[model samples]
Target: MNTLSILPFFRRLAGTCRLASALLAGALTLPAAADALPLEKIALPPGFTIELLARVPNARQMALSPQGVLYVGSMRAGKVHALPLDRDYRPGKLRVVADDLKLPVGVAWRDGSLYVSAVDRILRLDGIDARLDDPPAPAVVRDDLPKETHHGWKFIAFGPDGWLYVPVGAPCNICEPDPERYATILRMRPDGSQLQTFARGVRNTVGFDWHPASGALWFTDNGRDWLGDDRPPDELNHAPKPGLHFGYPYCHGDAIADPEFGRKRACDEFTPPAQNLGPHVAALGMRFYTGSQFPAQYRNQVFIAEHGSWNRGRKIGYRVSVVTLAGDRAVSYAPFASGWLQDESAWGRPADVLVLPDGSLLVSDDQAGAIYRIRYAGERKASGIPQ
Candidate 1:
């Protein structure tokens, strides 16, 4: 059946309950004509092109398998979607890898296993790609995670060190959370062993990536809201080593003291952000451009998805930005993708960005429930360069 025909059945089969009710509410908040949406609505640079990769409800935090299958984890839908791709990068087919999950938001594949993070627990499915149609029963890798529904959904990634990194966001807009709760980055073994706090005071960093050259962990932190339109800016931070602190609650932006959490402590206690990504720009997933297809200037720069803002009177973000670095310092910033928010009154939210093997970038827009592929066609080279 066509995707449109299958959506209604899926919606009914999803059952009528509180979670389903919430999903319905969220769906209603979306644009009325979701199918008519085009990539042009999401602005990008001149030479770059955007195409819808797939349509999956509430898709976020993507992970790709070795064979190039895109695995998407959902927040409101409580399922993981496996999207099949042809050799040319066209989305060929799609299937539900796992369902009935409790607001699963993070997904990762490692060592022949798939890891999923829900609000209160972490689950593992061994040999996932081999059993995409009928995934095996999951094993609880870890439980007792924070149960707070708001801002508790995770974005998990397996670092180069073979440890799983997870973000625990502050449950509220701006508050001094419990010690075990928000504003921290946690790392643990694949089996949920050796849990440790890698960084502290990081407020709602939904996306992060390890620098390919320096191995330092760089993350994008969303600033606290309700503080007006442009006081405290969102941050792009670089943690050169573990145990570092990226200020939050107590301090924000460069050295602006928090209106609520500010105390006698010195702002110098924490490492300031490498760059200030404009105020209220709900920055999410980040990835270093390591692919060779883009211009040489694009290499190693950080691409961040700014999910945009709501609480502010004048909205910002809603587009992706590139953060350039020079020897561990943010040298410059520029917009890589735009138009997601349209006229500041309208809406489209980009949640994540992933670099494929072919040097193309795949961006996920959760508000529209679509994934867009972006590729750079060199202006210097013509369309038909004779071999």
Candidate 2:
């Protein structure tokens, strides 16, 4: 469909449903536009400011093209959007790139094509950035992925090795399924050839990135639930090379044995997490800071979006977190931006984060159906840190 046709459809959808705001309690006001929300409610560290980049319904993952067009995907909304940005990297016109897709939660840009993952299939829109106003029909890249809806949505990215990496989660909360099909990260050439499993024994990984200097893979794995609030913490795992298996059905954080499957295998047989995050933090989309916008200390640090916990009695996450690394080891993990969850109520949930070329960061909140831009505006002292 053309931009004109899809623009009206979104306006109608936005006017009647208010998809994101409806999830909140009755007390919260329904912001017609993202700007209507009280921005001060979101708390950030000193010298940083956040603003609404765009109001994208069910915005789950984002990809930016070389020509400055941002493509966003949706999970439940079954749609993909493209927003052309101006010279300031601010969004200009919004257009629907594709719709009627199934759980299209991941998007990636490479070599003038925009790749979208819809559960079982990967579709590509060719020359998408140059034709946002009138996008062409999507061509299939791959369609043989597992179709299980349980934890089936994927996050895809091109690694430093020039291969496309995709993860497949276990179909159940915790079970040993077909090793070749589930609980693994797979990589393939751009044309969807030479598919091979990269990492195994992963429960569910929604985000991953290669280290800036080392080029090793790091990912966030959501821990299996129903183990109480503090039992199995989510994980930040490192896979320096292929054939690494992260403990999943058998073991959890720091070699904690699983109640059912732990007896089958020893915890020490598999790789352990580099850093154990909060229990059920649902950490997603992470990126290594390669821009000079922040302090020098943050140059190679990793920033994560914690989607927050739902089953835990006391909620955690719903914030942007940072993991400081010291030569491949995580030295510290802390909150960078929070305030989404207050007094057991949350109005937004962060799903993904992206670092722009200009050093600003973009965060996508699926619950709020909006994208937020975070920029470092503080002055740095002689110590090379923010004052």
Candidate 3:
């Protein structure tokens, strides 16, 4: 049978009742028809070209194992997928590793195991690299997380400290919930013991990374909505130590006090953002460029995936952005790739970015259901920025 023809049957055979129901209901959203690669439409700084790496259904967060296996998780599809690559770094067959999960949007691979987050729980697939064809059942690493589904899907990573860092978003758009359970970033041992809040007062942060040189944590925060189009901007924040609070319900980027809750606390009580981004941009995943394939200037800079705006009258941030840093401060922010949003109609929404061992970057588009590889093949230049 053709590869496309067998997909539905494979899903039926592998999925549980709930996943099958979601499939039958036609809930797996896909992108519209576009030409192959469509690289012409996506504007990038010269010397860089983006290639389609794989087509994963509802591909969200991505994790690459030490052995070169690419694992992806989905939110609406409730599934986790694996793509084994060939020697050329091209993808092989796509396999469903786990299904029937609850908003499994985060994945992390470490020491021969794959960890997936599903709202209230964390599951691990042991020795997953060796069993792509027939994945083993996932064992529960932890099941004590809050079960709220509103902004509850997590983005997880193993920090430089060797602990698993997980974010629990505020249950509402702007609510002062319990500090310990909501609007906080939590870190725990790999075995799920000794869970503690790392940071607090964060409304929602779907992406973060540690500085390559300083080892400090930097994260992106989506500003609360309904404040018009230009009031509060998304934030790029720095947390050099634990116990720091990035303003949430009380204060927004910089000293912009929230209209409703601003009276409760002074804006100076919380740490301000390192840099403020466009309002309603829905900034998601971010990574500091540690690859040598790009020019020297691109080193240690941050790349962010802007998932685009949902409530804005004019759309913004459907592509990747670069933030320049100078000793813990964001000096500048600009676009690295655009044209995904043409006249307010977006053909793609970037969800996450990952750097491969070869110094190339891989970006996941959940709306387009695809992953793209960006490589720098140009000559020795001054910078990767578009002139």
Candidate 4:
């Protein structure tokens, strides 16, 4: 065949190969439109690129240890996972460290042990890094949490003050639950002693992290459902001290009072959100950008995984977003990566975000059962502020 005739043949072959690759990547989970390296559909800022790192079923919260093991927690899968990273920061084979537990969606590593949060208790795997192939049976650290399954899954982490922070979500959608217990963020030592309420009036907080510079705690709070599509906004909250209430059950967002419970107290009775997010966006798993791989402008900013809205008529979120902070206030909140939802059909749901030591970002998608790495591959500069 002449050169012109063969050109069309090569193009057809290339397209066929691409389609097959996408199907094989997510055949078990996502639709064919969002598989393999369909990352092309994903949008990021200039100089940034995203690639697949690993696949972990039901990946929720993520914690990276000093030795390069990335521990992930799950809810529906009821398991805890460990993914080792090579020196170049690529993910190795995944290992399920623990399985068949109740909503084990929180994992934190301290010293040499891996701490996991089940529905009603906290468990620990001693020396978990040294026993990936044959992890020891989890030992119960504390087992006195509430037994209610509604909003029971947790996202846990170690604070700067050496306390393991765990959130106990309200058992119901909206109610006058005891502030001392339900709708509270609790903190305890590694041995699960001296447990006390860190913050109150949190309906359901699935993610939190201390500020890199000031050590102030910040978190994402999901708004109550049935409040209509645009009534109450999901919150990015700032809790620098204990006993601050973020206005759950009685108030929401900056000053939107709860209709059923707001009569008991004014909206000013509690602390307001640092930034008001989209209504019913289901924001979860946030981290501060403290690495050097990205530009200096990204330092100390917040990275959030919006798992997307299931209740809204027009779907929103389903992407990783960045919140720029000036001092203690959020100056801007914008999308860092998006396009998981296309034509009202979502193929991937971003569950959590983690910053690697090399400064690349890791995003976990429970719906797609995959983890993706976002890296800066172009010339780096620190001149412009994020608009």
Q: Each prediction's Cα lDDT score?
A: 0.83, 0.89, 0.89, 0.89
Question: Which pairs, if any, clash in model 2?
Answer: none
How many clashes show up per model?
Answer: 1, 0, 0, 0
Worst window of 10 by summed lDDT in candidate 2: 378-387
lDDT string, candidate 2, 1-387, tens digits: 588879988898896676555656444544554235455677787788887788788988889888888889989999999988878986787799999999999999889999999889999999887787888999999999999989999999999999999999999998999988999999999999999999999999999999989999999999999999997999999999999989889999998999999999999999999999999999999999899998788889999999999999999999999999999999999999897898999989999999999999999999988888888887311111111
Off by over 4 Å in 4: 1-37, 379-387
- Native-to-model Cα distance after best TM-score fit, residue 79 in candidate 3, in Å: 0.7
Evaluate residue 104 in candidate 4 and report its C-alpha lDDT on the 0 to 100 scale: 93
| Residue 85 in model 1: lDDT | 76
Worst 10 residues of 4 by lDDT: 378-387
Q: For candidate 3, write residues 1-387 as lDDT tens digits.
A: 589999998787777776777868978633433324454688888888777787887888999987789999998999999998776787888899999999999999878999999999999999888888888999999999999999899999999999999999999998889989999999999899999999999999999999999999999999999999886999999999999988889999999999999999999999999999989899999999999998888899999999999998788889899999999999999999887788878878999999998899988989878888888987312221211
Q: TM-score, each model?
A: 0.87, 0.89, 0.89, 0.89
State residue 366's C-alpha deviation in candidate 2, in Å.
0.5
lDDT of 1 by residue, 1-387 (tens): 588989987787776665678767765343435354545565566677666666777878899888878889988889988887768877766788788988888999898888999978999988888787787888899997888877788899998899999888888888888745578999999999989889988888889999998888899888888778886888999888998877777888879888777784568887898999888888898999999878788899999988888787878888889998887888999888887766665456889999998999988888878787778874311111101
